[model samples]
Target: MKRLSLAILGAAALSAGSAIAVQATAIEVTVVNDTAVLETRMPRALSDYGFFTDAAGQIPSANVTPYRLNTPLYTDSASKLRFAYVPKGKQAVADGEGLLKFPVGSALIKTFAYGEGEDRRLIETRVLLHRADGWLALPYKWNDEQTEAKLALVGARLDVDTPEHGTISYRVPNKNQCKQCHSIDDTVVPIGPKARNLSSDWMAAMVKAGHVDAMPQGTGALPVWEHRQEADLNDTARAYLDVNCAHCHQPQGKASNSGLDLRWEQDDPTSVGIRKRPVAAGRGSGGLNFSIVPGDSSRSIMVHRMGSDNPGVAMPELGKTTVDKDGVDVITRWIDAMPEKTF
Candidate 1:
């Protein structure tokens, strides 16, 4: 990405006995943005779209703005730096507690990194482009030198040492897998940027900037993940499940056949995986009876599958190779906190 910055200055003079001159800074730096490149073509390099100011994809252009979700999806605990860009003169429409309906030519950029401070390394950057046809997802792998990132159309796997799971083979999902996670009723859609999950501060800023049409009804409806311990138990656990598992577990998702709906709005206890027997007899479980047994997590099949790393048995089956102890702990506590119904 070639970003050029030019400083322009001007001087104004006023008529007086002795003419006085005042200098003013006209403009700072003009951002290089080619909206046409974003709408068409699948270039070999991520920089071809001209989204970032630098080759590392750290500095965004003027049109791009960074954003974060209150509760994010956990993908092997990768530190996801999210950003969004909309074509000038176009604003995203706020859906009812759902995803912001971004217009065509909008782009969602996410860079997945690992490690802390100086040791940090960006493994990949995923882009979701809103084309005239539909949303398309692409993965670009970063180089060892931490420079430019190239599109990995087929995806890649590399062994890396992680803070949580030690040295494990990390899978950068292929284009088809991206379609799988984003698929909603056979149409690819974004899972993040939901109105309820956005922070109030971000909502206000986006509104003020005119990027978003207006503040949605339920901004910050989900508890912040960092301060989740201080929030309501049920709400926090459900939020985690919504971000992490609900994409596939909901009725319109790929895992609809399983009959467990973990969406935050789902109120029914049975639908939310309590006292509900497996739709499929075994369901790749260890002969567990219910998805969640009130006041007992060990017997709950949800917890059982979540805590496992087995290929055919893990709950999510994608995004995570090892277990999320904190997530599992929260769900476990939530289940344990439930009072068993007395017959």
Candidate 2:
């Protein structure tokens, strides 16, 4: 009887272990092409790869972390992943695809993963061209198949030997950092359709704008969300803010602070700070008055809320753990972008 009990216990343990191994998780990568002039030129975009599962829509009982890459370039002598730089304004039109114009003088290289997830994939990079002519931001684009995407900019360097050793040194941003800001959205929906976990409003707009021919709609399976290089700030940055702050600052949100709102397109300086007094009466009422002190972010209560450790003072109250360094940098840059004079 004792022997029989031991066998049963071992069986139970194995079953539990198998179940734990199948838990699902998100996978992402953010490569910083240091070669790019401005960080802004590196398109800050996230594309959702479909759920990886076996027979069911569940993660396989295998190690997934091995798939992570820390370099901007991938190579496989066995596969054909070539690295090349194409000038911008020059259109590379393939038979079935649309004209993909490299942003004048920018270049890129392609390589394949030798070990895992092997396929001839692109590792395109570009630099933000800030010249007397025009300041060009980062360019990025996504294809329907998440597997196929490209990053293009105004001036980029490829096939150059750098101390980093590889074609590009990749820096993968923390996932929770992104989740922190995105979690703040009212509906918790991503801005773009391909990246969105729910709904397709923006996708419809893209179709309307002639950015794409049709909206991606299918229930068969989650399609690969291709990344679009060279996306406008209106679509990418604004969408990011919407998912990150709109929930607490919108008219319906909990923060009715001094009538200031941070919803998408609500960039009015006067509307961003204290009109009469602080929202919670005396809390952080620095006597300096105004909610967002016009141009000086240091004097603004809104900016203060971002770095505050106080439970009562932190903006987007519940997502502190997820707010990583990258998210903080992006927010700071955005605040800095605000005009000096109240508009």
Candidate 3:
């Protein structure tokens, strides 16, 4: 198997007017040729280089900051922690509608793990690097000992047992699969870190610290997905679906041919999948008549896809190998509570 070690230069290479350098030493990264090599236990793994800090240790890294999204994708029952960092001389520019145009060489790291304390098992670490050539997605599978992670280019599947949910099959997506959801206009982009997702205090601090250029005036904040207990069921369910499905279901996305728009910003109810018929779902529709039925989830093709893990029938063609029971239940409840409407 081929191996590569990159001495990632620090932000000092950029213009001098930029912010303070985030790091002094070159960040070393190990690249493997194939998944089979990573399957074998290898010494001096990716984690040994210290590009990412252990959240459990609570040690502060110069450039890393915990980031939150208004709504996030559901990956079975695993918990996720996300952080992002930019090069020394670069600051992310705030674009319209909460999107931030990150400078080249920025990186976003997300870790997936199950349980807490001694029982905690690190599953994987996904890194999105904004290289000069464009964004690259790398998936690293954590060792059973939690000491390190190895690059898995072809991806891997593992059966894990959870406390709340029994045995579940988890899938780690490959580099190409990452592009399935991250690609927009044929270019890979960051899904999270939108200005609307950041807390008011956090956004203000980011602007004050010069980490970001500035927030658009009169921008409204979006509620965290897990903290929407007080929101109405419809709003909560819409938010969940928007994050999980809108990435591809929107008009500008890969699934635009489906004619369904799941974005939270979409105000038209019919466009939001309410009584909207499928355009090209084919066998995936399960012979259902409408995308959503006001008071009947069993008749809703959207819910059916969410409940299925079959490749031919699933709404999302990649990333997940198992159904999100909690997410399905939420959608089911939301549908059941909807008032019956007449055409």
Candidate 4:
């Protein structure tokens, strides 16, 4: 393994109290290039790596304090566990809009696993490393013995079964596929770590720990979507769409030409695609007339795309190979409950 060292100095200027010359030594700190080494092979156990504080030796790394998104990407039946760690002396900052800006040397790890207990299968662990230049997305495929995972650039396709979704052709996206969703404005950024998607408790903790400067106040404090049974159908569905589709459907996203913005903050019904027709949808529209149809999910193109697993017509063009029935159901119910017209 090779190591690279980086030293950064604070730029705050020192001022003398009187009319006298002042001299000071610039603070210098070195950071070990852990991302370089971890990119090669996945550790036999999550604890083998120092990315998290684990005491129970859990497969998902117990002390990592798993975080959830209001809306999450659907990847068949594989459950995902995500963890993020910032380098010592560094912290993630928030953009003007409250989006988290992870510092260079930060790493976000997500593991996709299937089944449970002895029959459990660790599919792959994807890592997003923030370097001085930019972010790098790397995927590591787990071995059959469940001992280790190795870097896999080309990706893989496997026939796997999930108790809920049954057997399906699962595809592990290649490096290029990762950039397709992660890149916004031509720069790779995290899609799920936005303040709106985080729980309030988690956000407060991050602020108190100095991981982020501050969260937006008042209306800016977005609530995390709760389980369907506990939350309003409309809110749950909107949150789902925000996480799963808004990344590409927003005004500045790759699919912006479609005229649909699924972001949570968009309040205008027309802009959010309610009763709005698709733009240049072609076959992707499934012959539907509108993106959403008020009270009819059956007549909504968005619902059609969400329910379809066909490569040519799915809402998301990548990362998923099967229909997310629960997600579709939630959205459908929301549409079903909408009034035919809103003045």
Candidate 5:
């Protein structure tokens, strides 16, 4: 009887070990590109790429790093969670103060959310895949259950409650519309992830982790949005414009024809919209002459269009459907502080 009991105990221990092994296997993470999916048809579901460890929790899997921009693009004040997934054996390269060049088969994931604390709900996740041919932009809309995000080729509109604006129609840009803000020189390129716009600490850590090849030089610091009051006014305002408008206003961008270069590196006052005239005359110009009029925020075309609710008059024709009061306030403060000048 004692011998029989010992054998049963040993069998139980073996079963427990087997269970432990299975649990460990279940928790192992996998994060990398799906080359076949990238090179071929777009994946119908975001889960098909295996980017997240927990979709509901917004947790990224192994090799996927979460990062934040010093000053992010304001999309109706939506909270954004961003991640970069660089494949094994490949690393991202810093390109001056411009965007980091991700190797082929890498991907960028961004989830836009709304609400506060426990009530926060994810609205959409936009992915930019770096394929052998070029970058591909795809937007995914999260389900009401928050379990999965499915491909939204044509995009969707939903009424979302925002802190600044009450319930408003939030836009999830279609694949084509995604190309508009992301495109530069007719090529879809990432506007964010510029070394200058990123935290120096974050960059250093990435280098230490061997995920990035080198720490970029000449990356002038962009002010932290949360700590902008403590930072220089010029730095704060320029950083905001660079992240929000420069992608489209730069010479290589879709709005290149407008001749307004709001890039952080653009030192020219005229290019930065100090008494610069609008390229065309229309209601979009708000009957104002210059894009920015120093010392006169009220008369500045930038402020008028930015403050306008009219679709035709709003500065950013896409991505924004409501007026950005906080953004307008920042620009207004900058313009108001500028010494009065005339063209």
Candidate 6:
């Protein structure tokens, strides 16, 4: 068995502007498998915090301040093997055997599958390393169970390292930075093709680390606050949608053509336009009315879109790869719970 380390390398680019020097860093990552435990260090830097909306559009800085990074990288028996969910504090680990990593964010990442074993493997994911603290794992799925054939991330830690600048820092990706890509909402609501596998062990460990609240009880839609409304969705729901939907449904987002802006604070059933009758045969099929056909949940186009996997339809348009039964249920309840429509 070969041991490997997964490192997210950040490249610092400097440019001289007039008399001042400007510096920018590009994220680079790599995953290797050899055998034996491996230790890898990623240079780190302290940066003033900035708000970045995730694919879902939620902001994470409010929850975890001071963006940080995890430096050392490696895999373990507990790491993600195939398409598994990424628990809060867990990351994927791998040995050189059947796993392969590619250079994407300037670093080599475990993206696709390889070798005959890969075809038989059920889960796939990229390993994320935290310097000493630990690591986590993530994966993608497209069914409704949200549990079967699913994967999970385990063992993430942050390590200390010295950069070329001689500054000591942890090369860990902060909760917010991780949210930037993995999360659908800024950092509040997590949505995407990838998900956090809510394994009992992983959840318990994260709670012990003080990184999360008690392990989530309900294994459905992202966490939502009590008393949230669509027009007045509570912070949690709004945040989740912002991350999950706004990425494509926003004004300039890819799915903007549908004209439904799912931003938490501004989700308007009216703006979604009269739900277009599902004429074309696709994922959003089987609907009698448009997205929310005034009081008719069964006929609503939005319901159909949320319940599909036909590729050509489905709400997020991409990434989901899995149908969130909990998410669907929440939406169904929300739609059904809406007061009898006047229209």
List TM-score per model, in order.
0.89, 0.35, 0.80, 0.80, 0.89, 0.37
Which lDDT values do the candidates have, in the order given? 0.81, 0.35, 0.70, 0.69, 0.83, 0.34
Greater lDDT among 2 and 5 belongs to: 5
Order of candidate numbers by lDDT, starting with the best: 5, 1, 3, 4, 2, 6
Clashes of each: 0, 21, 0, 0, 0, 77
Q: Given candidate 6, what's the lDDT at residue 330?
A: 53
Which whole-number lDDT from 0 to 100 does residue 174 have in model 3? 83
lDDT of 5 by residue, 162-253 (tens): 87788999999999999999998888988788898888888888888777899988554888888988999988999989999998899998
Candidate 1 C-alpha lDDT tens digits along 18-113:
321221111113343445345557767777776765435365665677899998888888898898887778899988798999988888889999
Q: Quick one: best lDDT, which candidate?
A: 5
- Quality of model 5 by C-alpha lDDT: 0.83
| Model 6 misplacement above 4 A | 1-240, 272-287
Candidate 4: lDDT of 167?
85
The true-versus-predicted C-alpha distance at residue 62 of model 2, in Å, is 20
Off by over 4 Å in 2: 1-238, 273-277, 281-288
What is the TM-score of candidate 6?
A: 0.37
Regions of candidate 4 where Cα sits further than 4 Å from its true position? 1-65, 208-210, 215-226
For model 4, residues 96-117, the per-residue Cα lDDT tens digits are 4446888876777887888776
